[model samples]
Target: MTELVDIHSRTPKRRANEAMMAKIGKLIWALLLLSGFTRAATAGVLTGELDNPSGTLDDQFVYTLSIQGSFDGSPEFPKVDGLDVAVGGKSQNVSIINGKYSHEVQIQFILSPQKAGNFAIPPIKLTVDGKAMETLPLELLVSASGSPRLPPSASGRSGAGAGAGAGAGAQAQGDTPGLFIERKFSKNTAYVGEAIGVNVKVFSRIKVVGAQKDFRYPSVFQVKDKDNQKSNVEVVNGQEYNVTELESVIIANREGEFTIDPAILIARVAVQRRSRSRSFFDDLLGPTDLQEKRLRSESQTLKVLPLPTAGRRKDYSGLVGAFKLSGDLNPRESKVGDTLNLSLILEGQGSSSGMADPTLPFDTKLAKVYKDKADYHEELDAARGIDSTKTFRYAIVPERSGPLNLGQVTIQVFNPLIATYEDLKFDMGTVQIEASGAVTSAPLSSASTPTAGDTAPAADTALPKPEQKAVEVMAKDLVEPHSQSQLRGSDIITSSDWTNGGLALSLSLIGLVSTGVLAYRRKPETENARMQRANKAFKHSKKHLDFAQQCLRKQDLPQALKAAQTCFKDYTGAKFGVTSASVTLRDMESYLRSRSVSRETLHELREVWSALDQMIYAPPLGQNPTRGEELLTKSRRVLEQMERQCGRS
Candidate 1:
């Protein structure tokens, strides 16, 4: 055999330097994981399932009921046909998610099949804290021991995290152990510039408290991670495993066949020490060692096809997906030189980077338009890939008075499914412009060419320019003019030196007196300004309500609800001198109660507030503008009530 090479050996100092560099790399890797973790946190949820739906007469199985959400009491398992069930063990998990405390409890039941047969477990119902909750009906099937049931699917694929439960070790006797990671692509083939969803799942039979992952893939455009990842319990080969998913999107930049490399995950898993004397109680409170495991996902291949050039449109921005665009003018009425915020919101599922902000088609002669900026926000949906919204805010300044027409706005998108281009159009309609309140001494620029400062609201005085009156003297004339006397009179000190000195002293005294009068006048004006701000709270809230109603008319429910919610928060903050973010429902109630608001009124107001919160945060109702309209109305009523009780009091 050939002698092995020893080229890897290094000097002592070099080795030390390498070790130090490795430590620094590990620290950076840990920090990156922590940063990604905070941005993807989600609130709690509840779920239940049979750990192993399919097993043999001699196999081990379990039914797990997990409550990650807020619950006061435990759920009692009910009887199911053809199966004997008993409480086996309980586990509690406490973790910090995004700086907030999160606690979850899982109750496991030992499931033993009574004669090998198919069985249906009826819905398990329970009353927790006076709230009725129930789990979905589950199905289980068992076979004879001699003919072991080939698990529901190919039983075993192993990697890291979790151990075999009970006799699960015996059932999957010859399979690999540890946590298993699997990758599934949404589509095996895609058109050029099409977006594809990439999902990777880490399945573990043991508890995986923490994990760090890195994914490698071929060239793509604008790959973005999903906003949140969720974990749930799944069964594999008569064993219960916790399943956590990692989701992302990859854009096909060019047409060709590409193979994505395996993604890797480093997980921290707890391994229990199994003993013949160990009981369910011992298992619940048993000693376990935390071990780090490395898992790699199976590589996947994708085929990207070139788009047909025949149907391409000039305005197509290489975007592929189902998308729609709509726009509306904010504060529809404006002064001639005032900047009008023209907002265009484009929302749908597609390649985010492919859709560039379309150039506005507004007639420059009527109004000068320039893009302020664009904002992109997205909420991940497993089915649609992503719910993406891009908002383009353009500042428009009207050059001419009267109803200035910004004309029509339109966007073009490519639909990969149909191999065609879609033109989404929006009518921008006319906006009334009141002549600018202030007059300028200089000639005004044409609408097609706004002045440099026109992109923002004019900082000129709103009260208009002061009249330029010619004075009888310049700075040099501040002195009594040196005698412009005729040759004889001018020669002599035509004006007395004492006269010039006295005149200067008198002028100085007048200036000082005027300054004193102005200073005295500002004292009560200062107090009035303070009071004015407090009095305008109700007005500002009402203005927000109006804005919400406008959004509702445009069928933008999310924006409308947000505006309505802001209306309430702003009113409370301004009136109570508290931070808007600190105003909560309970805080508002306490403040109102102190104001002597009746209990009945408070209760009614509470209902409205809760409904607004639900609609704004977790809306159960469908995304329809009617529900949004109702919120606007109710929010307006709440603002009106606050005004009636607190205004002018």
Candidate 2:
């Protein structure tokens, strides 16, 4: 009995101990679950890498920072002592895998070594869900001379950075021996509107994959056709190099001292990467990398003097070249009130594209005159530079029946070489006219007069009489009236008469209402058509402006300037219902004046056009990246002003 009691007591104690142990185990399991949840919430990775771990001091490399998993904000880069960093590009990716979301953000920076030494790129910091994360530090060794040591490729990396690196990478490579650019100018001093030649040469000792160039000059100067000459091998500075020459013609529009910016050439050179393997197969399969090298030419200053004002002619046409003038009157005989055609041709060389139509001096005693717009044609001549011809046509109506003189035509042009003004004259002689014997109601034929270079026969002075054609008449049978009372006197009243009168009145009222509705509908349709035309004009102008901006970004001064000018010209043409090619600077000025455009605005427009023209005619000294931006802004403003004026009209 005593042993049984003791066993029962131990059993109760054992049960109690078992229950306590179970509770403790449950608590431990809960804690482990909570820890796992915390880790899942804070899970993230940050890493950094360099494209090239070791390179020359003049070399440039790409530094990349990548973050994987959920992040709160962007990564913050700590400034390094010996590295110059520029943001190259950025990309992001988000995906769901196995029911879990993953996010990645990668940023690329262009790293240029400032000096030759070992440098540590500091760790970058970021916050992921309020928890701090740090990236691994990168080591870079820059020497004075040698090929760069490339690092192992990173996982999940894209090759877009390589494409962006093509242009800027040239600067990442240090000063390469036997590679440079030289700039030469025909003359340092010139008169305004004088043509100048600029030559740019590139020398390279290494194999080049591709090249990009940025050439810029002052706004006061104009750059013309840029010719890229065939490259040839040459020896310079005791080294053989592939030499390329680019030639451009430039003209200064303003008289002042201006500095031509330095031209920059970026070349992508094929470089062989060092391989660690000594095996023959490995050597044969070694990788090749493209390294960028930049060469810049020295900046130059030019002095431009204004044209001389002494002995300037009153009829001077602002021409600065050699030219000749000729005039002729078609049909030496005509009757009074008949139309006579007058033709004048101006042909020559030297800044011919900039000349305006020559003024014709006709005597008032000759006839009543109506002048047409002059037609201009230009061609590039290797011997004389730019050859041009302008033809002006006029229609004159004789008022008297006697012999009359057509008067003299005078044109004055400035000879830049001799610093003198030369006057060209054309005498039209005389013509005979007879009084009209009979008045005719027939309209004149709508045929055009013979153009200067046309081979067709001259149009007849009188309209051809129309031939009369006879037609056979057809007979029709007469129908009898349904009601005899309708043909009788109106004194008799009938129910049919009242019905017909009421129906006729109703039909007349309906016709009047329909006419009013049609008129109302046509008005809005006309307005809508006008609005659509206006919108189209605005869109076209914007497209040209956008193209100009793109050219500016590429550092293409000539194309950018041309696009800007074309934008304005297109807008003017659309608003005025004229072809853009037919509109000259003078015509634009006249149109703006008619629109009551402010004098200040006009002056601004002139300045912009002058600058653009200069760029088109002459090569500037240096590259100015910001010049395109400024021109773009100005052009946008000018276009806006023009839009407003057109809207008001």
Candidate 3:
């Protein structure tokens, strides 16, 4: 039994030794594989080729260079020493597959030989993992477009041509089609305010994954699509591309061909397609076939024809583009002192779309102009093309009239579309007017007499009472149903006997209840109280204002505006009873009016708030600071006026 136990222990020890040996063998194998990969990295191999002449001057050929090596250490592309590259010259990236690593690069050149001759592309060297690899030199034969020594065409075939036919079939499967580009103009004829649409497009049959970097469009040509209009991206017919269009105004500036150049897109794409592997293990251990192809798009050309001058006008003013003119009269017919509403709309495509404000000519002998309002709207394409409209409104009162003529409101613009000078002459047609006789009143001799049809001039002694009556009437006429309820209640309370003993009792009770509130709201008795309130208000306002400023800087006008409004409301709610969201200009006006604030002060305050709201929500002018300063001045003046008037309330 003892001998059996000894045998069992000996057997276990032998098995353990065998297992340890197997593990050590695996470690050795792993180390050897790693060393092989490391050695392979040090071998840098570079490859390059020259364009095979296609015999056509316009035909573009692509040249690709690839370098494969292991950067056992840090590696970068070898810098070219003495070569002036053409348009799209160099692109490079490091790639690794299986145990092999490579750095790939490409370039483009527009080649036009001075004369038919032999040419050679110089050899290039690649550095990988500290070792240099030299690429073979490329030689090319330059030939005329119509040459005779070319290879035989497939027209001559026979029973023994099977091998050649198969080779041709294989080549066809790997062949790539070339690229084409074109530029187009919408029209050569246009009137003033017409949009001259221009488009640039690129077409290619080569499979392109993406651009190495963003492609920059040409700069010499200006795009009328301001604000990034006239630009679009679309996938059409299984192809992806970006297009830019410009709508230039047809201004008859020079009445000649005004050529706008096309924006070009040059891209570098991988020529070889990635092949499929047999299995997961093959994918991890096999070498990938490396091949390359080159392609380029044809250069684009655009023709801008000048607008016709056959029926042109001398006062054309060179405004060429498409547009619509709209106008309206407030009171087509009115009595003297009655205001006439005049609105005109000029919207269209052109250089002056957003830059020009239309002016209306009026006859001062027949009418007196009071006030005018104008606004502009513009739309842009790509980042440069612009389409715009402008509207003007005016209040004109007939001073003395029989038949008043608005003459002609002439709008001048350069039409880039028609390539001619043009003008828009809008006639106010003709307005018929009759005199409104003066309003006369009969003499009255009563001490105190009031009538429903009374038209007497307000006397000095009764001015206050009559003004009060007018205010009451205006309030009743303008207020809504809900507000009317509140007004009625106020009226009832004011007419009650609260001015007598009841008022005294009520005042005593109110004073007792407000004593604590007034004290709490007063200048702090404790240092911490004042500091805490000021600090809280400051922090809240500053945080909101900072966010508002950021949004404004980003042109997120809506959010910036909301933040500004919130800041004011927050500050007021914390310091006073007014919440910004709940308060409005009208509310302030009513409060000031009740407190007997001066009309000038109230008007200024309303104007300040209204201007701020307009600037925040509406289209902005070029200088925001100017508008801001105006707002600040008005705000300060209104606040000072409010403080002076606060004591009175």
Candidate 4:
């Protein structure tokens, strides 16, 4: 009975062990399968698509192809045969999709076809997982430009419409599918020479492929052949197929309606769109379908009306844009030969570049006017417009006292408001001339001296030379006179008066001779050597300044500094009695001190020289000429002051 009980327990234990082993085996198999799947997912992959290309052989166009995929190994773009390709980026991106690890590599290329015909883009090969993968072939069409084509779908406003819809696909190829073109004017009413904004937009839906792309642009009246200014690129909705500005300065050649010629740019471009479903396979192999656009903006025309000839063209001096002209007289009442300040001010909407010097008609009979001065303030704008003011101040001299009439100022300019050009003229605002006011009363008068006829003179003649005997007798008669009586050897001393008088006279004569010699030495001709030295200093300083000006104009900072250094050296040699080779800041200061130069003046000199040195040896001060010019001006002022103080006159 005990043996039978042991057997039953062992059998149940054996069954439980078998069940556990089966469960463990299944779990191991599942883990192994999951690991193998993960490795496959990490393997390299590549996918791409090429948009269609269509345009004439003579016309240039851009054909674009893009690729997106994953790679465990490095990826490279395979060159497509028979196509002129320019590759851009072969970069990579990483992300996770639906909790699945993912990696992507992208490559882009531009192509321009040489021949016009049906063309096929060969498969692009890339290496991944040490294996090569390729993109499928793409179909392209190149059609002759200006051919009759189907009309584009009537959709959005301006064909680019409100939002991206079917229009995005249709317009992406080209806005205007047909060869029709039209011109539009922003406004119908405009004056002669008035700038009329016009737009010539072309629409087409043709596939374009090549190196050069197509463009459409706005139109302008009295302008032609602006096709070269067009630009083409993609936009948010689809593509902006347009060109830049076709600018024209309206100079009214005639008085009637004038038409502006149509501007056109024909090109080919690739068109593309997103795929319906982004499956893993599609992501690696790209979407099946690729779309493209090839189109041209049609030529446009614009009408510009001429200025009105009926209205009183009176004071119109061809002044355009809105402006306010006013004149003011300074000291309204002034005498003849006295200065009368007449100022004319014109301020309004215009480019600072366009502001011309105004002409004021002053009565030459009443006053002689000189072009005194003119001041201008202007703000230039690349967009919008410009605002500026021109002020002219005239120095008028009255010839005679009377009522003077300053003639009316007239200016004619295009009126954008009225759409018709108008002339503005104003007559001379009258000014009353008065007698001169005496600033000082004439009180004392100095009488003039009479001429030769009025004045008498006494006759004069030279005295004859005294005889030798007379001189000897007189000397003896004055015998006891000082030096005469002085004993020499056996001669006895007598009058001291003769000796003193003779000695005094001899001293006076010697002093006069010395004075004459001193006067001769002080002549201005003697200062020629010093003048030459001073002039040399000026020329040297000037040379550097001139060189600095030239370099500054050319925007060469390094060269400007070198020139400035030369200037400083020359200035030092000529002005301070110091050569450039031996001169230092300390030496300059010491030299200035010896001359008793003002501290402020000395500081200026030191500061300028130091700045020049720093400019030459250190990094540039923003712009070359500007910084150098400021330094040059300061140096000039300082050196001039120093020279004056040093008695350089």
Candidate 5:
């Protein structure tokens, strides 16, 4: 009974002791966790990683050292023997997470193996906030016979299952599809002056986030038609890819065999990492990585054959294509001294760069021909390829004409399709001339004399002869000089009298009258005149529209679009008395609505103006010439409506 009572008495004390010990243990654990968190918050971390741990000797891998925390300066990278190490670049990132600030500095190095073997990259040392820090060492294995193997994440595989599938596929095929380029010509053989199309295409099965290309053709050939290049997505060999195609017209100037060098393309591909268990801090501070790849295409050879020399004509202007020649005389019949305008046009399919002025065999004795500079216009037509036309103007004055025939104009060219030389000619018919009584008034030196083979003159015709005149000579003796005498006082006084009070008074009166007249002539500009001057924007806009039309006729699409846009902006600004630079499309809309512009007119104006703005900012590919013409017409109509509305206002 005493033992039971003692046990009951000790129970409460034992229970209290146990509770106190448990409280003490909990406090100690809390202190430990807090201490650990504070250390982590203050401490810095350094780590090293590899882009690909295993690769071939021909392949290059990236080695990166990342330091997280405050650092004194940049880290010092260590070197390894039998390896080429180059500094790539550096990047820094800063973030504040959960009330804690963190910073990360990453240094990248490109490692190229000189020989096939296992290499060890030593730790990199860095100074961080007056403390020493070092990155962990890394290892790389390079082989000579096998292809490089990228990490599963870098290879775009998600997990172990995907990695296994990739491994099995690689075992089956020995390699994976990669980026490549293909270059080819439309024709392997072409004539010396014929244009051959060349295409450079880049095909890649891998996902490319960014890319740059360097393409070069032989300098010996002339390049044309470069604006036809294209970029888009395509599928090849049952795999999707991004394809960029570059098209150019190449013309070989000389006959020879030439080889085109390979083109290089570099692409930066995004690499997605496999997901891993992370804390809230890590989720907020992860890195995004990208891989770069360089690819090249095979060279191409071309054979340029010389143009045929057989059946070549005398008037062959070194042009190689089908061509046509035409001529027109403004006035077929004119007086002796009247000037006649003659126009000769040469049009063809050959490159205009090689086209020269056509030679004219004019009869100088019949007329004085003054040739002007030839104007050459070339345009690229979507349907007809490249077409060029050259116009030459001549002013002819007939000395004496009756059924006189101006010689024929001829142009020779080699037609590659027909495999022969062609002679294009235009015969100038007879031109009649009436007698001008002012023949004698014409300059004698301006007359054209007959050439060696010119027709003989009529027997009754009289030629002008030089006139000679004789002059009589005579001599006269000098008369006796008058005696010298002193000037009289009265004569001196008379000469000085003009400078007296009367002259001064007259000059002052003239000055006052002139000042008043000048002041009266200079009138102050009124508000009405200012408004009228502002309204001149209509005329200015018309001038811009005219310029746009001229550019459209010349096939200058960029300039035409720019001028058209300027026309509308200037007209709107001037009509509203606002600066053109400050006027937006919305402002124009408001102004038009206030003026009670028709809905149809506003809609048409919006369409035309939007099209013009788009063309000015980003020109469309393969632009049809008709589009420019239509835009020009619409712009003219809108400007006219605005002008009429302004007049009404």
Candidate 6:
């Protein structure tokens, strides 16, 4: 029989691994020697244990009795208080090594608790080689049919969290079928370009055979590099559940309050197969049937705040997280004109996706540096959310031989955790360079070159070299001596200036009057008109709808769905007088709810919105016109509904 499983959780693929069975064979042989087994001819030893110490009222546990070496008649089984025990299965194995035979037998018994209470099973007495032997006693606790209960250690309550099955699941998702989903976010609020750590989980009480799951985030949130899911048994409140969880990082591409849809799971649950009468074979095999269940979590809102403008650094490249910067410069010592490799590794705990390259200060006279594109990759770790590295490589060709410097390479990052900015600097150690390998250049004298009114001196004249000298002034500033006489009469205004100034002022006033009239005439006459009466209402939405239909006809499902969603969003935004293009259906709901919009209108709006949204991300089922046509007709109808509700009393 298949055990309970979550399709959303990570399931280790079981392989035909005889290697593990070989190791178990070795272990069994070691146990034989430890128990003083002479050979298969010797009487076998007996050992017994319960598969699980406790189980729910609706659950069934197992106990196994094993004998090593060899055995006589079947060992007697024991009766437990307040529990029904039945033979679940039986098996045996024999091996002959170097003509010495060894054999083992195992008996499995199914223990079903009759009622919810504590029960103690007394040790079972058995005869091995005609000697009396008794196994140790055991205890089990079965809680009443409600939630599961366990001791503190098994619950792992300390680190897991306050609530078992808490978070996004239990809020609005704890419905029938004993299944729930949870989403743990590092922070509900984050800045733009900031990476938010998210863990999506599903908790279920019922065992499932197979399941498929998908999570749809708002268009504004970009989910990236999801971690491998892990499955575990978690006890929440008193109920036990098989919980599957995974880690992911989301970056808000735009700043807004967007509603995130719940995580969805489609699983095939295992239920007991019914028959008129039960058979013994059904007891061990546990025949069951698979029933599909669709589970969705509660919706949430992620508030993406804009990046802070205060105390921002000039070198900041919109990187929001803790980061470290280090550089590697190859060949510390080289000659001028030699190309050198410089690798700068910028690693951090947050996402560096779409991060621009750092600006390196290159001295044109010293070396011409060419920047190679950055290489980036992320490491996968469950404990530490996200770790990524962005490396910038550069090729430097020296123009002169001297002490070389690449200047200060600093990358500024905003640590959202600490709400602080860090300037990461790369240390470019002093690089010594040898003289140029090839170079030849000489200056031309004034006599040899065509001089510009400058004569060259004779070789024997031996003229003294000119020296630049600095002179100190008596005061910081001194007026020219004859300045009073030079400024006396030439600065007077004439009659021509007065004439030109008056004419210019008249023309400027005339132009101002004409401009004001034009502006007044161009102003919208019906500025306060309803959205339905606006110019871009039905006709504008029609264009988008037409494009969507064309896309659907061409069998471009994704593009068709996208175009349809756009048509709805644009028409709704325009009808509600929403100017921002980023507002989604949920956003519109809140916006309209505040203005006393009717529930019917809101419902209609949501119906169209959700259908388009689900279809856009949904995997292709086939090329079908029903879905596309229905969406187009529904979108058009919603626009009309808004029109009717616009001004009618």
Per-residue lDDT tens digits for candidate 6, residues 215-322, read 778878777646356778767657677777766777787888978776666555665543322334456566454444445555677788877778796767788878
lDDT of 2: 0.68
Regions more than 4 Å wrong, model 4: 1-27, 42-45, 52-83, 130-132, 146-356, 363-400, 409-424, 436-649
Single out the weakest 10-residue window by summed lDDT for candidate 2.
Answer: 163-172
Q: Compared with the true structure, what per-residue lDDT tens digits does model 4 show for residues 332-415?
A: 676778887877777776422344555667757777888765788754321213356888788888888788777787766655
The Cα error of candidate 3 at residue 147, in Å, is: 15
User: CA shift at 102, candidate 1, in angstroms?
Assistant: 41
Model 3 lDDT per residue over 444-515, tens place = 557457777877765865544322333344344574456534665436555356567688898899998899
* Error of model 5, residue 581, in angstroms: 27
Reference-based lDDT, residue 236, model 6:
60
The residue pairs found clashing in candidate 1 are 159-179, 160-179, 162-206
Candidates in order have lDDT scores of 0.66, 0.68, 0.49, 0.53, 0.68, 0.67
Evaluate residue 409 in candidate 3 and report its C-alpha lDDT on the 0 to 100 scale. 80
Give RMSD to native, each candidate. 33.1, 16.6, 18.8, 21.1, 22.8, 27.1
Quote the positional error of residue 232 for candidate 4 in Å. 20
Candidate 5 lDDT (Cα, 0 to 1): 0.68
The global Cα lDDT (0 to 1) of model 1 is 0.66
lDDT of 2 by residue, 474-499 (tens): 75566664566566677566799999
Cα TM-score of candidate 5:
0.49
Return the lDDT, model 2, position 503: 100
Identify the runs in model 3 with alpha carbons over 4 angstroms from their true place: 1-44, 49-65, 70-118, 125-133, 139-179, 187-195, 204-223, 226-252, 255-263, 268-318, 321-326, 346-362, 370-390, 401-438, 441-649
Residue-wise lDDT of candidate 1 within 1-649, one digit each (tens)? 2233343444666789999999999999989887765433334445677645776664446677766546665677788777778786677665553454445566777677778888887776665334566778888888875353332233443434233221111212101154667656666777766667766666666676655565666646446667467677766666777777667777777888777766666555665532212234444566453444445544557788887777677776666788888887878898888998888888887756446677777678888888876898776543355567888888988888899776777676777767787888888887899888777455555864557886654667343656888776645645455544534643565348879988999999999999999989997897676577668888898988898888888877778887877877887777666787778888877877777767866776786776666566541213434456776777777667767777552
Ranked by lDDT, the better of candidates 2 and 4 is 2
Best by lDDT: 2
TM-score of 3: 0.42
